[model samples]
Target: MFNDMMHILTTQSGDILTALREHILLSLMAIVIATVIALPLAIALMNHRRAGEWVLQVAGVIQTIPSLAILGALIPLVGIGTVPAVIALVLYAIMPIFQNAYAGLTGIDPILLEAADAFGLSKRFKLFRVQLPLALPMIMSGLRIAMVMIIGTATLAALIGGGGLGTFIMLGIQTNNNAELLIGAILSAALALAFSWGIRLLSKLSVRRIGVLLVSAVVIIGGFAGYRAINQPAGTITIAGKLGGEPEILINMYKDLIQADNPKMDVQLKPNFGGTTFIFKALQGGQVDVYPEFTGTVLQSLVKVKGSISHDKQTAYKQAKTLIKQQHNLDLLEPMKYENTYGLAVRQADAKRYHLQTTSDLLRQSAQMTAGFDPDFYKLSDGYPGLKKAYGLNFKNIVQMESSLRYEALANKQIDVTDAYTTDPQLKQDHLVTLADDKHFFPPYQGAPLVNDKTLQKYPGIAKSLNKLSGKITNQDMIEMNYQVTVQHKKAAQVARTYLVKRGLIQ
Candidate 1:
């Protein structure tokens, strides 16, 4: 395991370092921007105490909004990538900076203030020369707090295509790769420590420390700017994916095919996006051109199809494709040869103890056990609701949590039963027994490429290129590839490329 970890770290050194750099730079930028905006506001509010307090209250409200919620809200307005992420960081940071700045300015020695006034010094002159200097330490403390928050919160930025160590963290969860998760967590913690140290060093108010901080900031920012300037590629088609191993492989498969066919095709993979709703919004808004989606997801969630859906994969795909084209101006291509529908699963021990062979069997024991499910499953008509109705299940509890964490929760016996995708590598790896839906509640979830109509019109080759992936991957092929990524800890891109090569789809 140590050797394997070392190999992963070495091979991913470039990505790790780049992620670290981006994390630090983003935190620094948010802190600096917050300080710049809040310092003056704090100084002004110091004179008008009541109004200042009210303004601080507003900043406090902004801080109370969950970072991810803030990110989601910003998507429609600011779009995805770095800008929205940075804006969220800044919003989270404002309260601390404002509070400390106000406190620092107001806490100045009265005698010092009286002396400055008696000297007939202008208010602005006094603030700049005396009060501001004295309050620097307190302001620096607030900046430190803000920096810490930004560093932690910035991890969520990856959800919106904003790159950072969070990229690995998100990918790790998606693929069930513990090493990648550890790397992301360890490096993020390290970055927080390093940033806190730098902030502390600068708080001493030494000229050399300040100079060092300034120079470091400049180099980091300038380096990123230069990198971006030099690496801007033309004619790139942005393909997005929800955060998961399947999406990771699918998107990479698209990139692999595109690049192999035309090295200059510039297929950009935007992984770690939020959920179906967010991705759908992004596609409709033109933030992304193409993405991998499930036919059932399109039919039920996007198209809002009423009643029990088609069980036949081909029929479902055709219906979903037609509805999506008419409604969302999107095209659903021919599906891959796999179905990744959701199903209820429990530990092997539970299965044996309850003699569970189907949803009906589990339903009999449901009253005594606590069930865990993803939030989406809880809400989806074809998910818990439909299953509960079909099997007449009534559990002791139904805890909603992150889908990625569901397997761990189940393995640890934190949840007696949880919903899982049929293609999830963890299901087999963890030895969980899936309960058959004898009542036939869930619809077929055939995987396919969902492309924007505008993109297809512009780059006809994209449809042609992506369609080549149609009917390629089988159910067993998907399971193995998912295992290779989630259990074997191989990179998704490498796994996709290997599959293509094995199938003679690419050289």
Candidate 2:
């Protein structure tokens, strides 16, 4: 455990550093922007005593909205990426800075103002020399609070494809990989602590010079760092996806291939293990270069269209290829022969007791039992609601659990029936029986490589290598691979290499 922690800490230091820098830069930018606008607004409101309460009230209201909701709500209008994240942070940071600046300026000792007036100091001179200096400490306190808040909130930015430590945490939770979870959590906490300390140190060193040299230096240094990080050459190909049993193993395979083919190529694998929607958003925002996606998911969720094709491998693969290209300007590489379809799964004992041979039989008995499903499935069109409405099946209870945990729920009889993807290794490992979807409610989910168009174009050889494996892998093969990692304790790279060598894809 000690070694594991050290390994995680060492591997993640760069990412931790980067996340901290970005968080600090963003917070500083937001605070600076807010200070400029809010300070002046506060001054104007103070002059109009009647409107002062109204202005502060409005700012307070804006502050009450949760930061994540604000960021999510802005995605449609502003689109995904840093802009929305920054905007949300800025809005959240405003109230504190505004209120503090107002209090500091207005709460100044009346005798001090009188003394300046008695000395015949000009109004502008009194405002600048006396009022602004006295207000600096209070304004800085507001900034300090805003900075810390922004750092904590910035973790959610990864949901929209903005890169940060949150990326790893989401992945870890999805896959049930404690190692990844610890890495993300520890690193993120360290980053936040570092930023907090740095800011406090800066406050002490420059409390007296708040208006001039120190502030200018901060702006210049921060701008340079932000520019460098954003423009860093993206030599690495990052593969990210939702954490299902097999996908994580599959990604490791792809990463090994890329690395073996070109030692210079930096290949990074990020398994979301979260949900399909999270992984999809990450890909769309260019947070990852590639990931494994099902043909059915791409057709329904991504393309937002019903697939008219048959559930056969060929039909699904062809449609997926065309749809991905047209909709996302992405390339759906040759698909693996495997199909990971969604079906109703129950323990063998329950299946026998109910005489449930297919989905039709399960539907008849479902009303008396509890059902388990992945959380995101509740919101999807082809998920639980659609399943119930279409099949006329109603369960006594509906429980949402992670994909990794659902099998356990079924085994323990916590849920008599739960949704199972056809290719999940757990189906075979746990000896769970699946009832056929006779009504064809679920579309064929053929396994395929979903690649960024730019990546495909740049590395033409990648297409060739990936295509060779297409229509070759089966659901059984994927399950076995997943078992190798989760149960047998083999790394993804090793499993992938062994398979590739057996197929003559590599020496």
Candidate 3:
């Protein structure tokens, strides 16, 4: 584990550095925003005990909600990306900052106020000259607390398309790669300590110096953000991928194909962006230009077809393509050859004990078993719900977990069963068995590139370039590629490029 992490650190230095910068920038933005709102509000409510308690209680309530839950709630309102993430982090930060500021301002010695009154000082003069400087240390103490909290919470942001060191964390967890997880976790802890030290220094300085430091932080962040914006080329094509190894691999293939054909075109890849709903919303909102999707997913989740879905691959693809074009006005390109449909996997012990050879066989003992399914599988029509309806399954408990975590849980026997995909590399590991879908509740799920129509209109070559991969990735081929990435710890981009080159799809 240590060697793998060190190898990743050495080989993926550029990615780690980029993620560190992104994490720092996000944490700083939240800290600054929280300070701006909290300090002023605390000062305003310092004398109003009743009103101040009410406000503090509200911040406390917001703080109690899990950071990931807040981000999920904000998806429909603000959509996924940095904006919602920062907003969630700011919410978590306000409680500590405001409480400490209010306490500091209100708890000052009465002798100081009396002295100021003897001098006939204005309220504003007393605040800036007398009260604020004395309160600086206490207020900065709160900032240090808030800063540490923000830096830690910011890691969850990557789960919802908010990029940061959390991306490394999520990638590591999904691929079962200890190195990736360590990079994210260690850096996050380091950032919190660094900022805490910086805040400690600010507390000792005069109020004026603190103000200068705060302003400088904002300026530096703004400058960095502006520089990226300025450098982003016109007609830049942005591609996104859903969470997990498969989409990441596919999106890399898409980028490599486009670059191989049009060397001049600018392409950006947002891997592990999010789930089906979030990424689809990004496409509709023009946050992304393209992403990979499964045809069965479209019918089952997005479209929610009124009747039985087609069993045949081409038939299902055509149906999905037509409906998607009609409903969304987006293009669903030609699909790859493989069908990565969902399946139920269980521990070897559970299989033997319950005689679970097929989905229907689970009916006899399912009510006694605990099932841990991916969150997406829990919600999709072709997943747990459909399986339950078809096989009359009634598990004692249903737990929602992410794909990689579910696999670990299954391996540990923490869960009796979980949702597994046909091409999942984790499924290749021993001690787990995929139950036969005798009822065939799930439809064929062919992977395809779903592109925005406007984007295709502008970059017409993308469709042609991407089409070269149609009918290319077979079921075994995808399993091998995914294994290379998730199990062997190979870079997804390198794996993708190698496949494209060997297949003569790219030079």
Candidate 4:
């Protein structure tokens, strides 16, 4: 494991460093904003006991909300990227800083305050010289706690394209890559501890020195942000993907393909940018120019077209393309020659014991089975709900769980069946077999390039370049690539570029 980790870090040093930098800037920015909002408010509320209590209660409630839930909720209103992520981090941060500041100020002796008053000091002068300085220890403690919390929580920012160590963590989880996961987790913990220790040292310094240090810190962070803005490529195209190894592989392929054909066209990839909703919102809000999407997802998730799609994948692709073009003004290029639809997976042992080979075969044992499904699968109209309706399956027990955990439970015999993407690498890893969808309850989920209409209009060659992938990728090809990334712990870009070069799609 150590050797594997060292190799990964050596080969992917640039990305790991970039992720660390993003994580640091994002966490620092949140802590700075939180301190700005919280410290003053904490002092102001100190004199108003009732208002302070109420405000603390509100902040506590906000802290109770799950970070993921907060991130998901903020997507529509604020869109993806640093804005929502920073906002969420700040929300989580406020309570600790505010509470500590209030406690510190209030805990100061009334005798000390009286001494300052007797000295004929102005309120502002008393605050700066006496009250604030005395309260500095507690305030620093609060800031330290907030900083540590935000640094850890900042990983979730990657889920919504906020760009942080969380990107590596999420990708690692999706691919079952332990080295990648450990690198993200260990680095986040290290960052938090370092920040807390630094804050402790700062608290020991005099107020004047602390002020000078803080000013210097602000300038450094600001300069970093400014440098990034100045150095970024002008008119660069952003290609994004949803959370999963396959999307990561596909997006890299998209990048390699476009750049191979149009060498000078600057393209940036945001692989595993987020889930369906988050990435789609970014696309709709014009944050991303293009991404690989599924025709069935276009119909079921985006277009709100209810009912079953056509039996034939080609016809389904046309239907989805037409509806999406007319309704959303987005263009979907030709689909790859593959169907990565949903399927019900079972343990290899169960398949033989129960004689289960298809959806119809499952009916014989439905009443005796306990099924676990991904939450999205359970909720989708054409997912578990539709599957139940189609096959008249009456599972003995049905439960909703995360997609990854469901597979584990199924393997452990805690669940008799679980929902799985047809091309998921875990299907091979666990030696599980998918029960054939003889009824074809789910729609054909054919992968295709979805481009923003305005972007395509501006860069007309983008459509041509992306469409080169149409009808080219086979199921076996995607499955192999996914296996390489997830099982072999190979880089997605390396696997994608290799495939493209092998097929003469790129040099």
The better-scoring model by TM-score among 2 and 4 is: 4
lDDT of each: 0.83, 0.73, 0.86, 0.87
Better of 1 and 4 by lDDT: 4
Better of 1 and 2 by TM-score: 1
TM-score of 1: 0.84
Count of backbone collisions in candidate 2: 2
Candidate 2, run of 10 with poorest lDDT: 205-214
Residues 113-201, candidate 3, lDDT per residue (tens digit)?
99999999999999988999988888988998999989888888787677899988888876777788888999999988999998887
Error of 4 at 309 (Å): 3.1
Clash-forming residue pairs, model 1: none
The residue-by-residue lDDT of candidate 1 on 1-507, one tens digit each, is 567567769877887898887787788778876766887799888989899989989998888888877887888887787778888998989899889989999999999999999999998789878887888888888988888889989998888888899988887776656678888888888888888898887777653456466668667766876788599686668999888777989999998887777887777888777678777777887778888999988987899675667877777888899889988889998788888888888999889988998888886789999999999899977678878887789999989998778899999999999998888888778888878777767888889999889888988877777778888887668878888876766788999999989988889
Off by over 4 Å in 4: 1-14, 41-66, 69-79, 122-125, 175-179, 346-381, 384-402, 405-418, 431-435
lDDT tens per residue, model 4, 284-336:
77778898899988987799676767867888888999989998899989999
Pairs that collide in candidate 3 are: none
Return the clash pairs for model 4, or none.
none
Per-residue lDDT for 390 in model 3? 82
- Residue-level lDDT of model 2, residues 1-507, one tens digit each, is 566556655755665576556555665666666666777787777567668778888878988887666765675566555567777877877788778878888889999989999999997888778887787777767777777777667777766555566766665565565676687777667766776676666556443465574468557856875896798667767787565447766787677667667778877766533456656665666666788888888877788556365566677677878877988888888777877888888888888888988888976787799988888876687777777787888788898888878888888878888888776666777778888877877778877888888887788777776667777877678778877765454556677778888877777
